[model samples]
Target: MLFAGIKTDIAVDMEPQLIPLIDSLPSTVPFVGPEALERKRNRAFKARLGANESGFGPAPSVIAAIQSHAGEAWKYADPENFDLKHALAAHLGVAPTNIVVGEGVDTLLGLAVRQYVRESTPVVTSLGAYPTFNFHVAGFGGRLVTVPYGDDREDLEALLAAVKREQAPLVYLSNPDNPMGTWWAAAEIERFIDVLPKDTMLILDEAYGETAPADALPRIDVSRPNVLRMRTFSKAYGLAGMRCGYAVGAEKQILAFDKIRNHFGMNKLTQIAALAALKDQDYLKAVIARIIAGRERMVQIAAKNDLAAIPSATNFVTIDCGRDGSYALAVLNALIDRDVFVRKPMAPGLDRCIRVSVGLDEELDYFEQQLPQALAAVK
Candidate 1:
């Protein structure tokens, strides 16, 4: 007898069981990386533009900082993220207590969901805004209520109505939205915030804020507990691979992250790189100019191809294919087959467009050359 009366024999088939919630969920990946597609096709893409990564890359100073800190990777990043938090606080005109830095906005979104979401809790979002937020909600078993877009833009009023009707504790909005690149003016966003229910929490994702017009972003105010504004280094700072993002809000709500967050999840190199990127505003401005120019070139290309390009505030442009969803999808697949990488929104109302990122000039040139051929193939 191994232990007095306890049976020593165990069933070999008895494995550790997943929690009911996790076991019930489907295995889903929110975004498929271009690398995976290349692997499946056994060929690399000629133009790598589907992922919305800034092909422009990180600032030179940020690169230098990462190289200088390479040897320090042996040490774990500061658990409190003290220096980066303070730097972000100074930049945003908020106290350190009002900031919480994380791996990226994606990770922070999960953390924020865990803070308020539980089994069957209501969460509200635009129908096709960002899939990762929906993934997080489903992982935590929060029931999602979606509001449809109004003219390719996130319908703020409808989202507000859903929040009230469902009494959702959490709602997400991406200004200068993803997949599609439309944005509302700052005044409209402020009006939405003013009317939002005090008890509901809003996750305002400003991942593309750097690429938007100055007036597109409202004044950053951390006074309200209901709003958590997310910003990332992935877009204009050209640090997508570095994976640094932060959320700013009232001190009390910011502090809640500490209860559930992985304290040392940040990489030392990422922290150094983010801090350095934040200091180089001149480089950022120059990159934004290039991004705007790229957007214009893409629009021109769309017009020349006889497709209509939606006005964009973000780094990507969504071009309408002048037909139904099937035709747009055929165009996208044709481009992919011809070695031009791009993506399209799959949600019903928004499915008639293909999204293209503002890649480097050469890549965009490759896309421009291949687009007509792809359209012909689809036709």
Candidate 2:
């Protein structure tokens, strides 16, 4: 080694080479959790109505199920998720093989992106659709082609057109959407599916299906390889903390999830909780009714302040502030300052509205009391 006693000119840089893709990517987090907001404000919100979580809480049976399964925490969840899949299939009138249960609809979205998208692979969605899905597409190096919402609902025709023009491998549509809470009838969605490019795989995220009208959800048809229907226990089921959800699609398409999914990601207790929740249909029905009642109350609150609350089919309502994003942001901040938690859309066209989730009467009353002041402060 001493024989190579080199000159200074022979010395070379020792830094590791960074991936070019890493340099091209933007540093961003998709959605900021409420806990982060609490940390920033250094105060607890008197009313939590932002995340669209079911404040009504999970079913008593589900809670009991979780408690009973507490002792099973030491064991890993079943990799196959066989029992849950079977239960879901029986409930949805589909075969067990056509179902794939995951940690939540969010995780399933990532799995779907992994299965179909690659560098520069085209993916289609609405401009302000679920940000988590968009985040997954970006993480996998996919090219996103977004269509603007038409009449406050996802533009089905425009989405299809983008998918066709881009020859996109995947497309995402959230029925009874987040932020907006707008929905199309079952027939309309069916029509949209029919017109979709045969080769393009559609992800129909129905996270709020239980809250929607009976005819809002199309019949379960796992026969089509191009369509995957995603549902979650987080919304109407009130098991947001449990993190349980599933996808129903053609048997072949469902099996692809097995190639990449984190097999033991589902907590054993979550499975028990979801199963019990499913079994208690009466409780689910009651919660849905209460959510509807809450939505009506929210609408009344908005009307009292001379604001227009958009009609909703989900657990949340979007109130139009009759102004720009800045004003809406101001109103949101004012509400936050008043110890009321809420959120708003940030995309250009949709940003004029503040989205509020269904909460208890006291929470809604607090919101009602603070809303006028929030509006005046913003003004």
Candidate 3:
């Protein structure tokens, strides 16, 4: 319309420019949320047992901190993230310079990809690991070489072989991995590190670290230039909505985040929530115990159905439905239809299982009652 007078014989086009990488990208999310499904079903989920979010809730101290500081939302958060960095550093026995706080691990992952992934830059990861990380790589025009899981766990040896074979500049590993909910011991992780090529950067995602055994987490080592460890306030702290996470590595590697990170992207209240959550160690331990109990209950529910719940170091469990991907998917749809929100891994070998997040007692009860019904209906 603006060009009505100037266009004469030619038709007006209002197309905006987009980068080729983005232009070629598909508009897809890693996981469709329960809310979206609810919209389609026209009903609410009775059992919210997906997303691996803590149903135990954040520490009371964190809630209080958020309430006390809620009025200060007008101001921008400290771009340096000074208080949080210092708190995390002191807790982890590292220098503040070794920590880089971001909106969440997902954001930090994107930043990491931005720093390293150029067109066709080879990045290695388990085929069905964190899809968001893969999405970031794709967004940045990186070439992904995926290794399949071994025995329901990420094949660390295969990952190393691929990295060495391709001379990949970057690789991703999720300890206490998402979707699968399996983990490697710290000693095993150390051995994996030993074999890595010196120049390859490893993105070690430890989002479920709090729920994992202490022996599963290697001690904080900011000395490693080739590895960045990602942690979050989302899982045990029940602050996923707060969007706060941090990455730790050598000072230089941490500093690299500064070059491309959105300095003022952090919200003021999230800082308060995370700091308060960190201060309450007892609450975190209690939540961990609750998560363990919840995991047991879920396992019991699966067993009653003659299914096997995979041993999990993370907050959730992957239940083997004793069938192929199609059957597992049918069970998942059945659960969804029954107002029990759950998720499943869709990769070739991993698709025979359904993932269930730890939830409250009532929610678990709903799941318990509906799972058998779902199984029968699926059959």
- Model 1 lDDT at residue 98: 98
The Cα local distance difference test for each model comes to: 0.93, 0.92, 0.94
Comparison by TM-score, 1 against 3, better one: 1
Worst 10 residues of 2 by lDDT: 7-16
How many clashing residue pairs are found in candidate 2? 0
Instruction: Output the lDDT of residue 8, model 2.
Output: 61
TM-score of each: 0.97, 0.95, 0.97
lDDT of 3 by residue, 12-108 (tens): 6756779898999999998898899999999999988879888888999999999989999999999999999999999999999999999999999
Residue 311 displacement (Å), model 2: 0.6
Sorted by lDDT, highest first, which candidate order results? Answer: 3, 1, 2
Model 1 scores a C-alpha lDDT of: 0.93
Q: Model 3: which ten-residue window has the lowest total lDDT? A: 5-14
Q: Evaluate model 3: give its lDDT.
A: 0.94
Q: Judged by lDDT, which candidate is best?
A: 3
Ranking by TM-score: 1, 3, 2
